[model samples]
Target: MRTKAKRAGIACAISILIAGAAIGAPRDVPTGDGMYANIKTTRGEITVRLEFQKTPMTVCNFVGLAEGTLAAAGGKPFYDGLAFHRVIADFMIQGGDPAGNGSGGPGYKFPDEFDPGLRHDGPGVLSMANAGPGTNGSQFFITHKATPWLDDKHTVFGRVVQGQEVVDAVKQGDKIEKITIVREGAAAKAFKADQASFDAYLKDSGGAAAAKAKARKDADLATIAAKYPQALKTASGMRYLILKKGTGAKPVAGKTVSVNYKGMFLSGETFDASDLHGGPIDFQAGAGRIIPGWEEAVLDMQVGEKRLVVLPPELAYGERGAGGVIPPNAFLVFEMELVKIK
Candidate 1:
């Protein structure tokens, strides 16, 4: 009789494990008290509570988009029919572009609203995706895991209260049927009334500023290419001059690499140096954490290799440029020495 009871208990435990695997564990509400947005997707629904007190501007902009009161994608609901264009497992899911591509936006841009109290502490974080500082638009992303690296870099507007199971199940090409604000915040209503004036302002200055920046970048790239005639060029337009040939393992994706690097502009002014930090900076190759040019440049290198890499504006910071340090369309030069690949 004892043996039969023990077997039944083991069978029950196995069934519970199977059930748990099918449905993910529950996630806590975004905040103790706040506004929430219910996002319906093909997989399921996700609820995110907006941090109105912390990031009022960001929350208001998101609310206007969700409610279809503010102009977006021809003044219609922008998120509907849009797919989660970029999905990196254990990282985040990105969408909110009407074009389903990273380049599209609401035909207008807004400045970033920064808040020190908010952060990317765990999964289900809702933050605005921008080209750089003060370039917030319609694109936003939701984290599926802890991403402290994104803190202070992007605006954190909301957190997921329910449907994290849906978030975890979301994959690339999954569609966000629509997103609706569950409880309208006061901030959203105020921004709704100011939408017209804001639109007019962006229309007058945004495009003109962008055009000027592009022209400047083009000139910079031409100057950089002429100065580094001996550097080998890749099809992606990245140029590099090998300073030292390495005999160790060739770097590939998913490998953690340690390297010492000095970043500078064409004028020879140094912006950042890892040697001063006492040791090499370690990061995962091709993780999208670093600039695209640096990633491509390091992939061709082996441990103990040293190279001078020149990156075009598009590959480095592009038209948006880095905050204060790197200008728009400015070509960047990096002196990199790969210490090891772990």
Candidate 2:
């Protein structure tokens, strides 16, 4: 969780690691033409326009989960009685978690589909909520207002065509009665919300390419490990090299600390730096305000120490990498110098 000290503006670039694969391109449909979901919740119905042309696989997954066509749903409507579970007053209302707590899904996950044309520019935008990149399950959220910071980090697969008031009125613990898919026109009508259809869609949209990318990334990580044979390995799969040792006090859980860091990929391409954000960034240790990798590494460092830390995807952003900078399942390398502990 890198702090957003500097906004990237409208160019929140995202790089999908599936090289040369035109993922999410609609197969026999025109853009702007897709199915709708009539979500009947405890409050009221929120009609969402599914972006099938832009994010076909995500739309398929949502439709399949709603209609019980995907095997993960056990052949029953999955959202029939699920709670909204989480809500933030000025941010968004999240739901579709079967566990009613935010950790449950339909027993499977899928890759993310991001369309540059779609954005969280205002209220009523519908997006997937996941633990990380490519971990999209059945959980979703609707914006209560513009959420520009989320752009490129989450998949924007739908938008509310009607029921803004209902979306705003939704509260935590509100149950969704059922979600009915409404198909219109030839393109939307021809689509099938079944597991096979989704599989075909995934195949057509660079599933093989994704596999190749994973192989390349794995090989690169192995090479890095071999190169840094003496690097310290943490219990959580992180590796680091202490470049400079400091004799100052180590930061604790409640202490606020500041650091200057340069973030890069395994290829040595810099993605972000503290200087880009004006100066050193600060956060309280162990507060969950930053990524697990940063939290763990910083806590082990002294005030004036510097380290070259390598974070695996699970400890960084998981399958969902950060905006156009970090790719999915990427290995993040950071040169961090702890500046102060306040």
Candidate 3:
């Protein structure tokens, strides 16, 4: 819990935050509040808006990062001159690494506040991009289209208030021209509407909540794996592990399962990642685009499940290796979570 002074410092950075850990609920709802916006790097100009009422802390933290107030609070800026890093064909543009290299962070990590109510149904929504749940810090992304896969897992704090065109023009390696943080709480009318929807989800399927949570955990793992493949690891003395069960719905092939995951190497070196963007990552089952190891495990996942996947070099980057982050012919480990399937 945040102390009274820490809560106040959230707005002013004058108070100390001793242990503002993740206030776990379900695999839904974003942690933090207030609203914020990003000036962003675009071909021309674009401004994104954040809905603070729904995620006050997330928004407030964003604002603090933008205003250089985080530095005052013993934290460094995570967004300073960061790249839009990764850009999918028509999805979103990602950035916000203090290291400027993909391996950097905000000098601190924070827990996730998942409400399972907010969704990634469409474009303009801004969600916290992290290595995993409770690992969110200062990274964020802006969606270019309606990516329902992002619903209920990532911390979504704002939306593109206007200037989505700017997002349309962003390309890989594009520099963030500038990001202007703004405060615009959720519309009074929309607040009630969103809240009602949240309540409805809670009331309608009380029994399925556990199932949904498992699905979300699985989805989250998938998200982390896609982006940080190097993070995958195998048990000592074991060459690899197979997914081995459950394939009723082919998550890789359709909207059945959308996940957020992190990947690592045996040495714990991070190789790749996907959460830096938004949802665990939306893809079809058996899509040949990813590494073979992923192809084998994901097809077996159900919604809301989190699992660890370890692969031998034969199934991973092979001999050439992924180059930079991953070494030549190495074992890998992945912590995957399937957040949703719809």
Candidate 4:
């Protein structure tokens, strides 16, 4: 359990909340052409118009939780007493954990719904928070400033339709007294019905049970090692096997390198890949821009070299794993190909 620093682009930005007294009464907002969620906090009310047309899955999931239609173990409202667990004044304000802690969720997870149309243009943008890709849960955040870095990384389900002042004034530990869904728009009702059906089906088929079981899977390092018997092991527990030897010089500190890589869990579940979006990502070789394992491993590789690297959690995300995708003490596998060094 080493002390882990927060990653710059990681979405596990929400922190656990410390319980506090309420600041205001719960209230509702008048709905308009679309689905609206009036989030009543201790300070004031902030109304957001959900974008079901663009991100239907995300909007429906949120509405169901708010209406108490999506119950957990005992069937209770999810956001009634939860506080804005984490709040970074210029970044975003996060909440929606019933336990007031960032660790709590709706007892299940769902896939991410990404839409290029929606973006973090300015303040009042509402988006789902996750540990990584396809791990959307109940936690959400409202931005106070434009965050282009978070555009496609998180699901933008809704935007502040009214009450920017309240959103700006909110702080951590301020209670979310209630979240009321006003489906005045036709789109809202449609999404609400769809989500209800989805939740009911999940309850009937025990989808959450299956998903939880999958998440608790054992590490796949043994399987990978047996598959790649020729891999070399390092003193730091990092393992690697060269795929393609380079023709140019090896990269050093302060030199930038561009590479294509695919990162996966020991379970063979791919967590990220540069190919998924488009091209390779460039970063300084030993500038601490990536995980310690990557910085150290890539330093020895030359341009055009490709290697399969295996890393222990200690050298990766460690105790505080990246949100939900990388669990505690998890092992990882990466196929990295260096394209250029400058």
Index of the highest-lDDT prediction: 2
Which model is ahead, 1 or 2, in terms of lDDT?
2
> How far off is residue 341 in model 3, in Å?
37
lDDT of 1 by residue, 1-342 (tens): 989999999999999987764444433335444577878887777889888667666776777676676756446666788999989998999998878879988877786665777888998999999888678898999999889877766889888878888889998999988777654545534444136644554564457557756777677777776888788889988889999998898889989999999999998899989978987999999999999998998888988899999988778997667765676567889999999999
lDDT accuracy of residue 4 in candidate 1:
96
Runs off by more than 4 Å, candidate 3: 1-42, 72-80, 184-342
* Candidate 4, 1-342: lDDT as tens digits: 123444532334432121111223344565357788888888878889888778766776787777766655235567888899999978999998766768888878876666888998999999999877567889999999999888767899889977777888898999888787777755556555345575654464356545643564332565766777898999998889999998888888999999899999766779999999798999987888799889878898888899999887778887556755676556789999989987
Q: Estimate each model's TM-score.
A: 0.52, 0.60, 0.43, 0.54
Candidate 3 TM-score to native: 0.43
Worst 10 residues of 4 by lDDT: 14-23
Candidate 1 runs further than 4 Å off: 1-33, 73-75, 184-342
Which stretches in model 4 have alpha-carbon errors above 4 Å?
A: 1-31, 193-196, 199-342
What's the lDDT for candidate 2? 0.85
Kindly report which residue pairs in candidate 1 clash with one another. none
Model 3, span 192-286: residue lDDT tens: 22323433433444445457655754664575456555543543322333333334454646444566677886557676676667657866657
Q: Would you list the C-alpha lDDT of every candidate in the order shown?
A: 0.80, 0.85, 0.59, 0.78
Please identify which of the two predictions, 1 or 3, would achieve the higher TM-score against the true structure: 1
Is 2 or 4 the stronger prediction by TM-score? 2
Instruction: For model 2, state the Cα shift of residue 294 in Å.
Output: 13
